[model samples]
Target: MSTTTQTAYLYKHAHPFLPRTIKAASGIWLTLENGQKILDATGGAAVTAIGHGDLRVKEAIIAQLDKVAYCHPGFYQTDIAQDLATFLVSTTHGRMARALLTGSGSEAVEAAMKLARQYFLEQSPPQKSRHHFIARQGSWHGCTIATLAMGDFKVRKAIFEPILPENVSRVSACNSYRGMREGETTEAYVARLAQELDDEFQRIGPDNVCAFIAEPISGSPLGCMPSVPGYFTAVKAICDRYGALLIFDEVMVGMGRTGTLHAWEQEDVVPDIQVIGKALGAGYIPISAVLANERVISAFKNGSKYFVHGQTYQSHPAACAAALQVQRIVQSDGLLDNVRNMGMYLEQSLRGRLAKHPHVGNIRGRGLFWGIEFVANKGTKAPLDPSLKVADRIHQKGMSEGYDIAIFQATGSAEGGWNGDHILLAPPYIVTKSDVDEITDRVCRVVEDVFTELQERGDIREVDSRVESRKTM
Candidate 1:
């Protein structure tokens, strides 16, 4: 299984390295065919909220399969699908009127975009001109062409720029780490970002906009960066003033990833359209959703009476069943409480171990999701050279035979979105104090070793990375 012959037929993302074969996985650990047990620190890109293998999730999937696995979504409405949708809507406490489930976050986001467009098209008097979208910088929604156009993830969407939609625009992201001015308070920063967004809306002609989309807590693009205080409140006000919808893409931070059912709950700003994924299935299956509030639902109800958007697998019974069971387990186990308690411990442990490290530029995130940024000069906060691939190096090293740990790597920050690096640690919700200690220790070792090797080679830290100087908004 480890030999090249086994992977000859597959095309991999990192073609230079063959992916490891997992013999089994359970409770935050992956056992390789060679009997190597790798610690899963980042929960497979922050998706495995519950853990590696749970009999409860397995039984749910099996139960659905036994009943029925595939049926035309257009022809029949399965009980499991209805139950899951109802469960999701209830989590919103009636704020969200309906849940449209899909196979992935990208699909849900695409649906949200279409739903926004249709919402305006179906309005009284029909505001047909309202089709533009204003998204924040350093944001990542999805991979589809339209979703790509709305995202500020520079590297992923650069080659497709010519094919992307022209109706999308960007405002400065609310990144306090690099975007905040030296003397500005949180209120000033929020106001500044709000003004920038308002100006973008005016620049685009307010009547032409459909929605302002953002992540409640930014995922990979900004490396788990949370919004500055009052940032979302101001943004929401601007969106309301323009009569445009507000979309919160919580694909990577929602569904108990951030110690709550929704990341927006902590912000106290309920979004009109909320897109969620990742932990929705807790790695038991692939499922995501677009939740629409009553305003949008009522508009569709009064007008078209049906969403124009549909997929062959829109309400797949098996997917719904799996996710329903996953959410149930999260609730039954009271995992959010664990996420809060363990998350605090994980933060304290990481800061204690790596805060003073010379190359560690920033440590930020909430709940179990934490990001550690690396830089050549901690004082200047200048990113490490993208050419060095510091994040990739650390991630690969962590996954290597001796290290046997997995951490999420991120890049694409700074001007032009090309010269920054960080690694994320999002251990499972079931992790305890001991697990946190182990994860923190392994992460610190991996980060320190990578930088140490670079330092010894006289290749980094001797000079500030030539990427660019920090520019404050």
Candidate 2:
């Protein structure tokens, strides 16, 4: 078969320009069909935790296939699924009592929304008025309609606004770098954000709010920004006072990506509901889950005892087996400790290399997850025009020869819905010191070269001047 013909049949994510064709992937590297090797940074949207090809996960899947692969989730119970649920619950240390396995992060988020609504419905007093959800301004929950409505990622949500639910509202994201004002202490910043949330609840009528949803560490939409100290505690307090559930979407940062097994562990507050994915199955299979706290679970148990939600592949045996083995490997190998140690090294390397760069506005993250936001003016933190596509250029440059690295790119942070760029780097947890060094060096080179090329062509000076003009005005 002809190469062009082979590529022509598959529908690509982007149009006019086809993505690189991967021949094979193994251990943090992807080999293209043309024999170019690309380092798998960002882990394909922070999904590949243990790396590309692990024999253990493959063997576990095979073993499950030998037993039974398919079963109706509503009719029969699978032991592998049960064990996987138990393992996930155990990680929460009794904070969460039940796990509803879903096909992807979007499904899990949808489930969380439904579960939150159901919990209120099942309550003794039946607060059916609680139908609204409050999410942060710069957030990316998922791509589905309901999840998109809950998220304020402008690029994806703007066109669908007319069709999306109006029940979701937004507040400022807890991004100290961009959201915090000058001369403001971290305590003051936290207090301000908390008050904004409280005011929002009051405006909406506390009884009308079903939950307040947020990512423990802001993901792509906010450039991997972690909240300031006491942020989560304050937000949780507001939710508690309003009789609303707190839902943490750990889909991108959970399951050992953030140096801890769960990102919430370091936040000093436990969520009433949690959505976990990506690293759970380690990119070996499609899997995600929504965990319900004891309070929410008990309400259902005492009332209807039915979730009213089920997917055809909800508890597929093979997926559960794959994820179970992935978790087992994470625990037995003590990868979380490695994540902590290597995370410090990665942060140090990034700061040392990019902190003083004119275009690099901020570098923030935890564990293996990090994001470098780009700006036209570092002092003013003015975002480059979205048309420049700074992050996308860096990502493309990294894939080119002499710098074969894969990094995640995102925009829409400078403003709530648009006008910012950032590159997210989330290497595999199995990365070593040498690996970190190489990845950092390659990423630094790509960022420098892309900006250098843009400057040589006078592309950036125009954007910077425009931003400066806007700021002065």
Candidate 3:
């Protein structure tokens, strides 16, 4: 394969420059066409939990293919799908009563949205008014139009705003880093965010809202920011008061990425509907799931006895088989413990290396999932100009020849502003201390070198001065 700008594959950005071609991947590393090795750091958007090229997962998938590759959900029930759903529900300790498999995270989220709506309809009174969803600013649910309406990432949602649904509205994200007032206690911050959520429900009319969706620990759009203590407890209470379901979009943070099987497990709250993917199959196959708790399941069981949504690949045999084996491996290998242990080391290493850096505003996340927010001014927390593309530049530097590592670069800003330029560093749950050290070393070098080049070009001084001037203004 040759790197070429001209290709039949229509690229996401359609860049004029040619893209690097990966020849193969294995064991937390990628080999390019030229045979250069690159650290598979972000696990291709935090999907690879067991690392690259695990033989066990491959064997499981091959076995699944041999048994059965494709089966229509409406026609027959696959034992593999049943086994995987059972495994998923068992992991949730029966909190989620059933799992509906889907093709990707977007499909899972869309399924969750539909389930939430179907839940309201299943009620005795049939709450037809409960059609709207309330999601947080800077929160990302998925890429579909309904999910986009629920999500507030301006970069992705801006283009199709005119066509997106009106049933979804936004509230401020429970980001103590961004929304918390100076000198405010964590309790106070949590209360304020809860009140804001409540107010949004009132504004939208409590009966008109079906659910309030959020990520337990934010994903790409929010830079792995977890809410302060007691935040979800308060939000749950408000959701209950309004009779709206609480939906947790754990697509990126769940499945052992955040040290726990489910991110909500850390939050002390069980959502009515949960969306998860990315780490489900550990990148061995494409799979995502919408998990419905007992409350929602019971509602459907008594009413229509059916969920209104259906996907072509829902409950796919091969996908579920791949996921089941991945989950078993995660448990068999005790990788969640590794995640916690290695997560601590990764956190320590990153903070020790980058915490005091002038551009690093915040380093927050749990377990193996971590993120570093870049800013022009530390004290004021003013974001570097979007034009600076600090995170993108660092990503480019990391993927370059000398420093060969791949990271998930992201921006999380309210209303398309130039605020949250950050990069997520979620190594696989199987990463070791050595892996953490090397990942950190290369990551630090990338950030340091990118800024150094910017400084040499006098860009850092100008950004700092411009942000400082605005602070005064």
Pairs of residues at least 3 apart in sequence or in different chains that clash in candidate 2:
none
RMSD to the hidden true structure, all candidates: 2.7, 2.7, 3.0
For 322-412, candidate 3 gives per-residue lDDT tens digits of 8999999999999999999999999999999999999888999999989898887788787776667778998988998999999889985
Q: Write the per-residue lDDT of candidate 1 for residues 196-232, one digit (tens) a residue.
A: 9998998999999999999988888789889987999
| Candidate rank order under lDDT | 2, 1, 3
* Rank list by TM-score: 2, 1, 3
Q: Work out candidate 3's RMSD over C-alphas.
A: 3.0
Which pairs of residues collide in model 3? Answer: none
- Misplaced by over 4 Å in model 1 are 1-17, 461-473
**TM-score for all models, in order of appearance:** 0.96, 0.96, 0.96
Worst 10 residues of 1 by lDDT: 464-473
- How does candidate 1 fare on TM-score? 0.96
lDDT of 2 by residue, 261-358 (tens): 99999999999999999999998999999998999999999999888888899988999999999999999988999999999999999999999999
Comparing 1 and 3 by lDDT, which wins?
A: 1
Best by lDDT: 2
Task: Score residue 243 of candidate 3 by CA lDDT.
Answer: 92
In order, the Cα lDDT scores of the candidates are: 0.88, 0.91, 0.87
